[model samples]
Target: MLNIQNTKLFWASCLALLVTSLSFGIRAGIMNQLGIDFQLSTSQLGTITAAAFWGFPLAIVVGGFVVDMIGMKRLLVMAFIFHLAGIVLTIFAQGYWSLFLSTLLIGIANGTVEAACNPLVAALYPENKTTRLNHFHLWFPGGIVIGTLLVTLFVQLGLGWKVQVAMMIIPTLIYGYLFSKLDFPVTERVSSGYSSSDMYKAVLSPLFIFMFICMFGTAITELFTGQWIGLLLKNVTDNAILLLTLTTGIMVIGRGFAEPVVHRLAPQGVLLLSAIFAAAGLYMLSTFTGNSIFFAAIIFGIGVCYFWPTMIGFVAENVPKSGALGLNLMGGAGMFAVSIYTMFMGNFYDNLIVKHLPAGASLSVYLKAPENSASAQALANAKNLAGPEILQATLIIPIILIVAFGGLVIYLRSRKKSRSVAL
Candidate 1:
């Protein structure tokens, strides 16, 4: 189905995916570094990490609305600009607000990229949209692995975080050049003369609502881990950076094999399985108490591996020409939901940890002073009495979403069956 050797378009699709993947790594790794250097609390850190997702909802909404009108090339070019500007601002950012704004720009740019490219990939590979989309997403984890390795080395060698963020400019420019040269195909759905009113009507359809639910859960699954795993490790272990990379390593490996895996099970089956794995992993990680804690991350990575891109692929294959609007809404809604989830985690941590430090207590004292810190450390301390409670909340949210989305999938299948019966 790939036939990369025979088609530059195939290669271009891969390259575009690579560009976005590389872009995410630059932002995430550097954000982790910033959290440490700035002495930010988990809540403050969450805000920064979540900033990239803050603009996502709107970006998807607006990007989808304009994608067909503006064309893929223009939106992609705009995405490149937003990402580039975000990275540049991040390098120079001295305060939390600067970092937040910069990350927000990156979020917006990423939404634009998804809005443009998700549909483009489907249009280009109509018959194998799911597999190709899954394959295209391989670059995301691949880039994370590369970025993690490079950032680790750079940090160890005493290079500043600025250097790591500055490195993002390379892919942004290269991809911009390639996108400038590539020709994008128009999809059949958009090519038909469906009026603007009809296109808008599709956005309000039951199918679109079902897909949104999928996108939302999938977003929480992927971002909840990607954005928090590093912090989760630091809260539990000394080798946080290594642990972060290890989980992402598993994610890369999973995505590498996801094309064939998705092929065998198909998108819906893969999604159901992924949700189960993800729910179990989240519960386990949230309650982890031993050195075996690292295993939970691996499991979580495996569970979330096919989620984000597969959600995009599902939209592409099922909705096809929902056009740029469909792509933007999916990406935007996903990111926005994640940003909200991260913030929720942050607020809980802040109220429970940062706000109520006892008299004459330092952070270290509050963290380690057994009796005094016990309440504050409930979420952080794997052995704390309240840890399980917190973990249960995170696990339950996803479990519920999974059940809801699973029902939607079943309904769709039944509807199709009935249609066939009537025929």
Candidate 2:
């Protein structure tokens, strides 16, 4: 125990993240309705969904650089402003473009939460950096779980998804009140006397550069593949919907065990192990058959469970000089991965259709073809052929991560031995 008295602030940060998660779920639940109302295609709706992710890099990078200067309190206040405005805008959105802009604002607000509070948690619990960060991140998937239930409940009760979206305001306001009343401490970077230029330089440092590449691979492996779980497993098992839920559940429970793991293995050790499991699990997902599908999915779930938070923990722990900027860049890399790879995979899928399937193949995929549906049928066949390969391609990402993280572990061990000899 670090004798932490500011637990209220930590809980408030969780609340803020909870609100963000709720917005994410609510929007996803309502996408079909929004599409109907706007007469937008699924691809267009995907663009709306992407805005929530793509906006993260900009807000986090800028906020990370300035967060120490303004302090967590003001940075949180900025997040609150954007969150409030974005939520309100989303509620009143009339069409595709408006929804896009509103969600973009929400994405920025979401990134602000990560930028401000990750450092706050780090500064608050110096000895428990990995453990506390893991605990703090539980709210992300935890919030998603709760938000999904809220969306389902509201929809079941014949309430529109807006009602679920509106409910997030309660948590948002609660966090706002808690944060407004409290005083924030200085960031780890500031207390350590790292100047702005010093922090910026830390990001470009060779060690940080390696960590950046590792984070990029980690993000793509975990999230990029995750986005396509349903389509990838559509034919493998009938539990496609439950598959995502299962993965998220495993993540929440896995993080609960992070403290013990961090104590034993340390951050690099944990990442090295995580990469191994992730690589093995993705292989299982790409090739596993029979009753082993569930088994493989579980393995995959546990594999990625520790990745995102641990990566952040590693950067904050080892690259302390980079401060909030370091964590910011790390998170930025992940979000960028999600944004870019979604497009990349979509392109790959389309190319697969062009390469393998015939025109008008998708519309009559399983049923009789309506007139002028040859192109749609072609798309369906392409998805069938391409989706699995996209998933299998993700195995390459984790394989890269294994090598990168393995090297980091060796380097860390060498440095530790050298420090011991000097001592």
Displacement of residue 179 (Cα, Å) in model 1 is 1.4
Which residue pairs clash within candidate 2? 360-374, 360-375, 361-377, 361-378, 362-376, 362-377, 362-378, 363-376, 363-377
Cα misplacement distance, residue 61 of candidate 2 (Å): 0.8
Give the distance in Å from residue 260's predicted Cα in candidate 1 to where it truly belongs: 3.5
Clashing pairs in 1: 64-325
lDDT for 202 (candidate 2): 81
> What C-alpha RMSD separates each model from the true structure?
4.0, 3.5
What is the TM-score of each predicted model, taking all chains together? Answer: 0.86, 0.87
* Candidate 1 lDDT, 1-423, residue by residue in tens: 335422666565566566566556655666656755665666788888787787767676787777777777888888889988988898889888888898888878877777777777776777777776776777777777777677778878999888987877887888788778766666445775656776667767888878786777788777766655555556566665565577778877887677679888777778888888889888777778567778887887788888887877777667654655766688888888888888888768555544445444455434334443565464355323333444566777668767876886698789889999999
The best candidate by TM-score is: 2
Candidate 1 positional error at 407, Å: 1.7
User: For residues 263-290, could you state the per-residue lDDT of candidate 2 as single tens digits?
Assistant: 8989888888888888888888777766
Worst 10 residues of 1 by lDDT: 379-388
Candidate 1 achieves a global lDDT of 0.71
